[model samples]
Target chain A: MRRLIVGLCWVVIPWYLLSLFVGSRVLPFPHAVAIRFAELAPSVLLRHAAASVLRVLAALLAASAVAVPLGLAMGRIPAFDRLLAPAAYLLYPVPKIALLPILLLVLGTGDVSRVGLLGLVLVFQLLLAVRDGARAVDAHYLLSLDSLGATRTDHLRYCVWPLVLPRLLTAMRIGGATALAVLFFAETFFTRYGLGYFIMDSWMKLAYLDMYAGIVAMSLVGFVMFVTIDRVEQHVGRWQG
Target chain B: MPGVTDRVIACRDCAAGYAGRDVFTGVTLGVAGAETIAIVGPSGCGKSTLLLTLAGLHRSSRGTVLVDGTPLESGDPRIGLVLQQYGLFPWFTVLRNATLGLAIRAKRSGRRFDAAGAADIARALLEQLGLGGKESDYPRRLSGGEQQRLALCRTLLLEPEVLLLDEPFSALDALTREELQDLLLTVLAERRVAAVLVTHSIDEAVYLGDRVGILAQNPGTAAGEPARLLLEANPAGRRGVGRTDPLHHQACAWMRRRFAEAVRA
Candidate 1:
């Protein structure tokens, strides 16, 4: 709590000083922006935040649900790894944001397109993370487990999943940040009900303070998502630390 | 207990290798119940491979490994292995690792895994192994000796009929190694499990085994030859005897001479 307070002071004081020097509508004062944020209807901001959160959550859930199992299979089984490794190497490097136009065209600019694009970006990140993590497990550990008469399912449950989870969470955190950034860009294109739309709309209307307020709200979303993942990681990987 | 028999473990002309290249072959050995056969060989002599084959973790390319007169199979719970590196799962706490075998047995038998019962067994084993207060600690937190004891505890909890150990005390300091060796002998005395210990140290082989087998490096043309039973001495009589005793020194001297000659040839 003390660190958070100190960090806020550092950010707020610097912004306030900069705003004072500028004294222009382009960079409104911090106090004015805060006041404008307070004046806005809570429901309006809440709805935008909720919509953005929903899209990100949906994308993350879908991506992990598919990627983790496939990644584990690829990591453990030589046949699956041999088949998928080449494709993973080929597709992992392509900038996923470039697919936005194609996704919008195919999915018709709906929430489906937005969710699909974000999920596509996150799937590769998570799959490769899990694959590498699983591959990194020491072979001796598996042999020991095998000698104990652990079945195939037991090996997966006791050895593979728990060992891979920490790496998976790390990948999820990075993927979450990337998803938010891409969400902001995707929101700028179509529809009217997201933080990106609200901020861009306020900027076009020359309401600089409202735009700053929208930016603050979106930053809160990112902060909350990251903190949640960090907490989950700590809880799951307590043995690590 | 159904498959338990008087014959503990017997290997008849077993051969093991990887990728079409043989590491060792034509190895015939038998270990009676409660007997310890120490294998001392030069590096790359396939000592570890023979132990793995006996434990059923590696397949014999030719011939057979019989555990209680039954052909050995991989993942046989009747045989337990203690790797040289002490292959304890880092993700599990010491207590959890020690109880893993018991839990698996319960699940295999379609019985409810009584967590409290398993914990009691694990706690007793840990206490006996001198790891009483370290149950919740991960393997990484324990010292090398403690980690070794924990690995032994994990395997012994299952009451295996055969124990295959690969240089189980090679990594420890001199003092810790001796202490662990004594502890292992004590445990084996009580459990009466057949054991095959692989080591590079002539003293360790002489100190631990009822009979010491010497494996020659058959790297190229001599791949299918069996290891010769180099020495059969009653080392168990010197259990409480000091290492510096005249008998111990004589045995060590004799083993050193024989081991050097075997490796050179």
Candidate 2:
């Protein structure tokens, strides 16, 4: 399949070079860099990969946890929207990367700071999307259900939820992608064991092939995550004509 | 059709509009078990507001609307209002949209919806509206005509005693408009429910309404503008009495005269 071809081109071939060429430095290609990769080993690579993924996932999950409820609250209550919306808009445009010094000062040089930075960036976009999407739901549909003697819970489940969910899923797709990209940069700047960190560390040691290998790994991870989310969207939206 | 004993709705002095401003005042109307009524008016004359008030979407500024002698309330299960916007939930499939009313009511009643029964009714109604085989599609994927049909089906599945239609077909092309108008006429005639429709087109007014009214705009003051019912005319009854046929010419003439009178008043 096309996916198989892509996997081979991106993951298998690059990883092969990483293992064979970068693993065993035989010439001007440098045994030092290969020795570095080998010393790290498969377990270290995996641990770093897992750590990086977990950090990104944690940031995304935390952002969504806060954003969904905040968005719904804003959409349902006009007073809350008026009170909260201006502050979010004002904060959203400030580049999240620029806040690293502040985050480091507050949280110390740890995963907490990295995750917090990425989450701060992601939540603003997610909140806006959720608030606007939920607000756009038709008043008539809600009123119709309400008039039908539907309880508040019934209205939320049957009418409001259905009306707003597709929009939320779409927002999640966009927010998740943005958060992943931000996570990469965050790792490059402030982590010891991620694809971002690996690339930066290898590049500093003049290991161009290993740096390329790290870049390839991070890209593959991002692509896989995006595709998985896209699949979820399709499955959930299947009933829609 | 149900017997005379099954008279389901009545509106007595059911004058309603917006708060602090009147649309139609001292307006009384009624629907027998299987009767249909339609209200027609010029642009911005408050016909839609009246329909909303009657359906319990808005509270009456002046009087009361009753269902089988019980006062109407917001979210009354026996009433449905279809605005020109179609208001189809963009996230829902055609089948889901159509069955939403039943689902909401059932959940409130401590019973879940009978999906098979709801699906059957929705399918039949969608078929009648020419939306067959498109049940799994979303509103965004549907044509304007198709979305309107889905809205109609959604309203019909609950078997509302009163249906309020606010220019439901005006958004479509001429051909589609006529086609939908005819479909609605056929459906309403068969269902025999009371309907109050606000329309701009005189041809549509004559074609769809059993009884039609031309409403006037209240002269604006330092306060907000109010709306007044200029005349409550029964086109069908007039035709039935051999006074005048509800033809295009007659309807147009009536509209022109009514418009001139409203302006003069």
Candidate 3:
């Protein structure tokens, strides 16, 4: 708690001092932004925040649901790994944002495409994380499970899934940030509501205070997502501690 | 004592390897029910490979491992293996690790496993093995010796007909090693389960084995090459026997000479 307060002071104080020196409409003082944020909080800010959060959550859920099983299969089965490894290697490094145009063409500029774009961006991060995590599991554990007559499903449930969970959560934390970035970009185009759209609209209308407020809201969402993931990791990775 | 009988485990000219590269071949050995056979050899001598083959974790490239006069299938649960690293699942709690095999068995047989009953059995075994009150703790929380014992507990809970242990105590300090050895002896004596123990320690080999086998330098390379039986001495009566025992000392001396000879050859 003390660390958070100290960190906030460091950032806020520097920005406040900088704003005082700039004395420009583009860079509003912190108090002016705070007042603007309060003015917009009840209706305009809440709706946009809700829209952005919904998209991010939906993308994360969809990505995890697809990536985890596919990753585990790729990791555990040598033949499957051989088949998919080259494809994963080729596709993982390609910037997913670059596919925005292709996705936009196929799915049109609807919520589906936006969500699909975000999900597509996050899936590779999660898949690679889970695959590497499963591969990194001690061979001894697998042998032990095998010696115990663990069937394939038994091995997956008891051994593979639990072992890869922490890595998957870590991947989620990383992918969450990427998802948010992609979400902002996706929302900016053909989106009626979102923090991204709000911020861009505020900027165009010379509402710099409101724009800062939108940025603050987006940062809070990212912060909350990170903290939530950290907390879940702590709970599941209790043995590690 | 219930399953203790003349259910022999025999490796008949067994050959095993990885990726078509032979590690060992023609490894023939036999253990009568309730007998403990300890194998001693240098590193890369296929001692562990032989154990894995016998346990059915590794498929034999030649011959067969027979349990009770039938060829053993891969991953036969009746033959419990304790690997050198203990092989405790890090994700599972102590109690859960102990009951893993039984739970799987239940699931396989289409029987609803009595979790409460299994927990009671696991708890009793843990308490007996000096792991009382650590049922909720994961394997990472336990010391090396504790983890080894928990692994043993997991195997024992399943009542395996034969036990294949690969250097089960090499990582422990001398004192802890001896303590675990004694505990192992007690368990074997009580259960009378047939066992094959592979170790680099000559003294441990002599102390644990009814008969000690020494693998050749590059065992199982040729068609006829296999682990040759080095000594046949009953150490069963020597339970709790210290290193000072004349027979124990004699066995150790004989094994060391034979081991040096095998390595040289």
Candidate 4:
């Protein structure tokens, strides 16, 4: 709690100074934004924030479901890695948000297109991280397991999966940030829902207070998610220390 | 004890090396039930390779490894190997590491595993090994001796007829090393399992081995030829011997002198 207050002081003071220096309505004082954020938070921003959070949650699940098994396969099996790595390398770095127009046209501005874009942002990060994790399992551990007459499935369950978990959680935290960036771009396109659309709409109308409220809501929601992932990591990866 | 009863694990004329080069050649040893044959040698003598062959972790390039008269295959359930570093899985708690061997066996055999029963068995084994009340702790939290004990527990849980250790105690301090050596003897006596231990310490070999094998280079052989391992009986009969036993000291001194001569030759 003390650390949080000290950290807030670092950011809040800098921003207050910046606002005072700018002397423009564009970047309002910290007090104005905070008051406005309090007013709009409960009724107006909550619904949009919920929509964005749900989309991100769905993307996280879908990306993990598709990537984890495939990443593990690539890591553990050389032949599988040889076959899949070429295609993954080609597609991983292409800007996913660039496909927003096509996605909106095909999926018709629904939640599906937005979620798909966010999924694209997160999947590669997770896949590469998990694959590297799997490949790096100590040969000694495998030898130990094999001495017990382990089947291949047992090797995966007893050795590879547990070793890969810490790396996977770290990748999730990194991927979460990229997914949010893509989420803003996706929601700006064809939706009335989501914090992204709310913030952009407020900015267009010169309602700076509403814009700041939407940004704060989105930051809080993302913080909640990142905190949740951190908590899970602490629970499962305690043995790392 | 090593040669009196029928051999539980036998390696005949075994030669092991990687990439078509022979590390050790013409190695032969037979371990009877409740007997421990310890191998001591200079580094790179292929002592570990010899142990690996017996455990079926490595193939004998020019010979055969037989477990109870059956040819050895990789991942043989009848053989359990403890590595040099005590290879306990850091990700697992103490209890989980102890029971993983049984769990792996059950999974492979397609039997219905009773997790509760396995846990009970592991709890008893950990308690016996002086790891009581530490079942929930990760391996990293344990001391080196404790980690070695955990590795021993993991291997022992599989209930193998034969145990192979590769320099299992070389990393410990002198006192911890001696204590673990005693604990190991008690475990082996209680279990009556055939064991082959590879070590650098002549004292450790003389203290634990029913017969101590000296492994060294074949100085007179040609460039392509590998090293040799030869076994000799130990009169100390390690069951009750300790640091104060004059007989153990004599055997260790004699073995050390012989070890120097063998490696030099």
i-RMS values of the candidates, in order?
1.2, 3.0, 1.2, 0.9
Per-residue lDDT of model 4, residues B59-88, tens digit only: 878878888888888988899899998888
Worst 10 residues of 2 chain B by lDDT: B235-244
Higher TM-score: candidate 3 or 4? Answer: 4
Q: Pick the candidate with the highest lDDT.
A: 4
Each model's DockQ score: 0.74, 0.44, 0.70, 0.78
TM-score of each: 0.92, 0.77, 0.91, 0.93
Residue pairs with clashing backbones, model 1: none
Ranked by TM-score from best down, the candidates are 4, 1, 3, 2
Please write out the lDDT profile of model 3 over residues A1-54, one tens digit for every residue: 685678668878988889888884768877788788888988899999999999
The regions of model 4 sitting more than 4 angstroms off are: A1-4, A105-108, B1-5, B235-240
Compared with the true structure, what per-residue lDDT tens digits does model 3 show for residues B1-265? 1232234788666678778866766666778878888888877778898899889888888888888878888778679999899888777799989999899888877899999999999999999999999999988889999999998999999899999999999999999999999999999999999999999998998898877788764432454344443435544344345777786776677768767776664
The 0-to-1 C-alpha lDDT of every candidate, in the order given, reads 0.84, 0.72, 0.84, 0.87
Candidate 4 structure quality by residue, lDDT tens digits, A103-153: 788877799999988888889989999899999999888988888887788
Worst ten-residue run, lDDT, model 3 chain A?
Answer: A1-10
Q: Per-residue CA lDDT of candidate 2, range A114-206, in tens?
A: 999888978898888888877886777676555555676665666666656667667767777777677777777656888778777877998
Distance from true location, Cα of B6 in model 4, Å: 3.9
The candidate that achieves the highest TM-score relative to the unseen native structure? 4
Task: Supply the global lDDT for candidate 1.
Answer: 0.84
What is model 2's DockQ versus the real complex? 0.44
- What RMSD does each model have against the real structure? 3.2, 5.9, 3.3, 2.4
- Looking at model 1 chain A, which ten-residue stretch has the lowest summed lDDT? A1-10
